[model samples]
Target: MSGNWTEQRIPDQRGRIAIVTGGNTGLGFETARMLAGHGATVVLAVRDVEKGRQAAARITGNTAVQLLDLTSLDSIRTAAADLRAAYPRIDLLINNAGVMYTPKLTTADGFELQFGTNHLGHFALTGLLLESLLPVPGSRVVTVSSTAHRINAAIHFDDLLWQRSYSRSGAYGQSKLANLMFTYELQRRLAYHGSTIAVAAHPGVSNTELARNLPGWMRMIVTGLAPLITQKAAIGALPTLRAATDPSILGGEFYGPDGWGEMRGYPKLVTSSAASHDQKIQQQLWAVSEELTGVTFPVK
Candidate 1:
C-alpha cells in the first residue's frame, strides 16, 4: 500500500482470466496488454473481432476475443453465454467500454446512448456473468467510471431514459454516476457471499479516443489544455489496473489519480462524488435496471 500505485505494482496475474470490454484501443488496450503481459489469460471483449484479434496479436501472452456490443441487450446476452461456456471461472470482469458526450440518441434497446452503453450495459453483463465469479475466491468486478459523474448528474428516475430532453454531458454524467452507485450497491449485495467484490475506477483526464465526441470548440479547448492537464493512455489505465489487481482493495472502494483534482498522476485510493454514495438511489437504480434489462443478479 503506497501513496502512488503504478502498473509495476500489479501483482503476479498468472493463471487468471480477465475480460476487458473495449480492449482494442486506448485505455482498454493498455489494460489488456498489461494483464496479458503479466501472464493472465486476457479476453479482449470488443465489438470488432478483427480489431480485437489485432490487439491480441500485439500482446505477449495468452489472449482471446469475443464480440460484445454494449448498446444491444441481445449482443450482451450472446457474449455472456459464449464467455460462460468458454470459461468456467472468471477472475476479473472489467466493464471498461463506454460512450461519451454523443448527440442525443438511444441504444438498440431505446435507452439513452450513454446510459444504455455505460451503466445498464455493464449492469446486465455483470448480472449474467456473476455465477462464474461467485464461486471463485478473490474474484472482482471493476467498472470504469469517470470524474464527470459529479457534473450535472442525477438519476432522473422519472426520465431515466432521457425521454424528456437531453444534454449530452448531463446524460454522460448520469451514466458515470450510475457506474459508481452500481458498484457500491453490488458490493453490498456480494458482501455476504464473501468471494466476489465490486470496485470502480476512473481514468481522470486521459488522452483517449473516448473524448472524440467532444464538440468542435470544446475539442479545441481540450487540445489546448492537453499538455498541462491530460496524461497518456498507459498512465490513465493505471487506476483501473490497480483497482483490478491491488490485493489490498476492499469492495466498494474507488481508485483514481492522486494528483490535483485527480486529473493526472499515479493511481491512489480516491473518493467519488457524495451523490454517488446515496444508498436509496443506488437501490432504486438497481431495481430499475433489472426491470429494464430483465437481468437479475445471482446474489440477493
Candidate 2:
C-alpha cells in the first residue's frame, strides 16, 4: 500500500453504501469525502444534526447525515436500526469519532465521556448492526486510533468508569487501545466463524477536533507544532481509507504513518506495540465489553 497505491488503482465505489461516525469534520470528514468521491453512498453519522447536514452539503460527493450521539447506548441502537432499515448493506463502517485530553467527565450513560463515545458506543452500534455488516462479505470496519496508544498499558478494568484516579491521556489511551483490541477480537471471531469481512485500521497523527478535549494552551501548542510535525487531515485519512477499500488487506492488520516513529505519512500497513497484539488481553476486554453492554454479538 506504499508507493503502489494510486488514485487510479482504487476501485469504483459507485452504489456502495458506507457509514462514517464523525463524518462531519476532521479525519472522518476527509475519509467520508474520499469514499463518497469515489462514488460510495456515504452516511455521515454525526453527533450534531445541523452540522452534519452542513458538512454533507459542503462535500462534493453524495452524502447524507443522521443523528448519532455516540455517548448514549440508546442513541447508538436507534441510529443503527434506522440505518439498517434504510440501507440493505453497509460496505464500510469507520469508527472515526473520538475525544482527547479532557477533564474527567461522564456521558449521558454515566460512563467516562471519551470511553463511552469512542469505544462502547461504537461497540454497541457494531454489534447491533451485525445484520447490515455481515452480509457484505468484503465489508470492513476501520477503528481510528492514535500513536499515544503505544505508551498506554492500563486497561483499568476495576476502575473502568474511572471512579478512582483519573488522567486524561491515560483514559484516552485506554479508549484507543480498546479500539485495537476490539478490532482484533472481531477479526478473530470472524475468522473462527469463517466470515469474509475484514476489520482493521488506525490513524497516527492529524489535526482534528478530537483534540478539543486537550488542555487549551497544549492544543494551541500542538496546533502550532502540527504544521512541522503533523500530517494533514487528508493524509491522516489515508490509513482508514486504505483499510476500508484495499482489496489486498488482511484481518487484524493495523495501518498508520510511516514517517518519524509513525507520526505522519501516507497510510501504510503499520504495526502496533506487542501489548496491543496480546490475545489474552483482547479476550478479556471482549468478555468485559459483552458483560458491560449486555448485547451479545450475532456472530457465533
- How many pairs collide in each candidate, listed in order? 0, 1
Error of 2 at 120 (Å): 0.6
* Candidate 2 global lDDT: 0.81
How big is the positional error of residue 216 in model 2, measured in Å on the Cα after superposition? Answer: 3.4
Runs off by more than 4 Å, candidate 1: 1-3
- How do the residues 38-78 of candidate 2 rate in per-residue lDDT, one tens digit apiece? 99999999889999998898788889888999988778878
Worst 10 residues of 1 by lDDT: 1-10
Candidate 1 achieves a global lDDT of 0.94
Tens-digit lDDT string for candidate 1 (13-79): 9999999999999999999999998889999999999999999999999999999999999999999
The TM-score obtained by model 2 is: 0.95
Best by TM-score: 1
What are the runs in model 2 whose C-alpha is more than 4 Å off? 1-9
Query: Among these predicted structures, which one has the highest lDDT?
Result: 1
